[model samples]
Target: MSATEEAMNRRIVLARRPEGEPGVEDFRLEAGPVPEPGPGEMLCRTLYLSVDPYMRGRMNAGPSYAPSVGLGDVMVGGSVSRVLASRLEGYVPGDLVAGFNGWQDYALSDGTRIRRVDPELAPPPAFLGALGMTGLTAYVGLFDIADPQPGETVAVAAAAGAVGSMVVQLATLRGCRVVAIAGSPAKCGYLREVLGADVALDYHDPNFPETLEAACPQGIDVYFENVGGAVFEAVLPLLNIGARVPVCGQIAHYNDSGNPLPGPDSLPRLMMWVLGRRLRMQGFIVGDHLDRLPDFVREMGGWLREGRIRHYEDIVDGLENAPAAFIDMLRGGNLGKRLIRVVPEDAAGA
Candidate 1:
């Protein structure tokens, strides 16, 4: 059932493309009649909407790996929703699904983009976090790219984030020594204590480079690059020969205005280091790794059921607060996977 009896649909639209860090003013809240399902389509009520760093790039006017969210459009995102009215086979009212439902309260889908959610072992939000795309991302970036071996030294940045935290744990389970780098002392502590990272360093530390080097005395064999700014620079010299670097994201410069990197005479130096260190650095888009989704679901789902994997949601209450929550997440304000709860989950579980 829909959250309310009112026949209104509330949504946050992208009012403007941000110049630097996005502000609440960049998004506008508007309401209209609840949409009806067309032939072969279903109407879904959003339960939880994800606020990810990748959405920031889609807000820019220029082209990226994905198309930008046009002005006045419901912002692009992934959401866990419930089917309200269905005209399609294999779908019915009260069915939970995960889909590209954007930021709106209710959306219509043609059954092409929606996947039925199985909340038997975990909650619906897990379809958006660890047991979902986020977990798949960590699986692809680590095993497919870095190929961690037992006793190898793995260093991951943004270690407390949804993806990075998964990488930390996955690598640990593979018998690798994990070194985590996060923006704050708290995140560093979370990585060390909760995620079982061998050592966690604060990127804010002035002697971060020295401390990171000390943590991995055997040299970093796999460097999972997520927050790639100064953290990238600090980890460069510590790479062992034939090291693997999987560049998944660069959230550090996601909020920076203009060209993400300036004065790039450093490229020559980076090339020199790559040559000297025999490094293998490759950037990947998770979309390209979708083939591995089934593999991720099987392994990660088992881990979740067994309570071997830990997942967290730093949920912001209400649909109206989505924009503020998004802005705060890009600024390192979120503790775990940041999400906006549009409608509260059912007590019986969705």
Candidate 2:
């Protein structure tokens, strides 16, 4: 290998799967010689790697919407990358792209499913956030599934998060009164001040249930379920007749080892309410709505450009920091989209 090629690669792998919440010991960082581009492949230097709650599910040894990361495998993640070398037909060395490039400083792809990102349109990190999966999740879950109409009350749990923030902005743009539930007073303040939520409440408050009840006097017409344990329990009582719930994620239960909590089982009561209220509750993985990607891109892209939609990101430095960043995300340590800067691929441009 050439000396220049030996200068640039680092990777983080799954050292072991955690029984519950993942820790730094569950990951390993390693350095190696930079890879060369092969026929039909392009070598990309990662710019930003995303850390998300869904990654927690991938750490467990069980069936989920996606496959779990095997022990000793490089951690899986989506990233924004710049092509450092290219053997692929359509890609050039400077082209920026977004794809599932795992947790690494460098990755090689054949360019089949990669999307070329226009740096002129948005910054590289935006590809890992607002214009990417997070935005798409909020767009589809709110419009396509929940279908909130004007004057309806929309309540979203984790409302200050990457996806939930967009849910608030989009619902407000549609003329619905948005009630946001966040982890702390600070996050609740951001939701109300920056995102224009009509009402923002802290889930940590002792009277959170009563606060939510007061906020949604007309009842919750649309409940965007992000955190699924106690938050869902609180939302259950506020759901209006024929309310629509688009179950996007379950961050609250992501760290749980699938063991039932000791308590009066709430399923029987929940089932009765579901029947009596005639509520529509459905779970969705983003892949299930692939057909709407174009629609999301067009409409949400416009919302972003028109200043009707806003996004936030909490960036952690270095690939080695991803494990801690991910763990903190589960505990609501992050305020928006969590991302790690893997390398300085777009430094000169940004």
Candidate 3:
């Protein structure tokens, strides 16, 4: 590579901790030299960057399931990258991989947590969405944790998103009647028409709780909790006896300032429902279930080949726009998996 190319590594770092909703000011984009790989290491050029809701938590100062992103550090994220140079044994130049390359244009990896991606099986970006961690999250959360039976009513929040979209389709394949919830009409249409959800409801409607209850006439047998707060409150009273709730994400509450929400305490009501219905609520981190990845890849791969599943992505161009896209995703502005196209589509294959 030319010296100019090696000097063109651009990165987006956390400029400051967000107060409530994060703004573009919280991130600063800067250019730096792309470092050469040492023995047993590889240099990779990032192609696609994934912007997820969990990243919001990582930006905070408090402790979470993962360590917080330190100020002035490269923001944490996953990426689809191409091996540019390698001294690693198995990896070679031109090989594609999925790994934690963060929000940088180039990164070095010693093969830790890195997986080779076969671009022939699926498009490269799919590795960052349905065929990668996102798909595994849905598979593990729904089948392993929630365990919805055939003919059960399964309600999924954020039903048009990456993980939720997979859960909607997989639940349908399992013979469960799915009631999908989204923030907008367009996303609701995609959930019902494209994803094959039995019923789709717009959560912005004033009567969303009542509408959701009406849709699940038999009561919700399984609730995939993606958005917490009001969405959780709505699903609480509608849970059937022996219901299972897989707490996947709580996007709505991620931006809160840690103060209690102003309202009557609803813990007593939630407790009563849990006690009377014997509901099983479990929160899971996808990293904890990596042992099942091979099985998921095998089955989900076949489903993709047979056209039994379809994945959607909302991609933004350039690394500079990632912060805006991420902030938009956090506010429920995205229709599917939100990704940043670090490399232009025409040149991505190169």
In order, what lDDT does every prediction score? 0.88, 0.85, 0.90
Top TM-score hit: 3
True lDDT of residue 328, candidate 2: 88
What candidate 1 gets wrong by more than 4 Å, as runs, is: 1-5, 347-350
Q: Write the per-residue lDDT of candidate 3 for residues 314-336, one digit (tens) a residue.
A: 99999999999999999988877
Instruction: Give the C-alpha lDDT of model 3.
Output: 0.90
Per-candidate RMSD, Å: 1.9, 2.0, 1.7
Error of 3 at 134 (Å): 1.3
Backbone clashes for every candidate come to 0, 0, 0
Candidate 3, after superposition: displacement of residue 63 in Å?
1.3
TM-score for each model: 0.96, 0.95, 0.96
The C-alpha stretches of model 3 lying farther than 4 A from their native spots are: 1-6, 259-264, 345-350
In model 1, the worst 10-residue window by lDDT is: 341-350
| Candidates ranked by lDDT | 3, 1, 2
Model 3 residue 31 lDDT score:
92
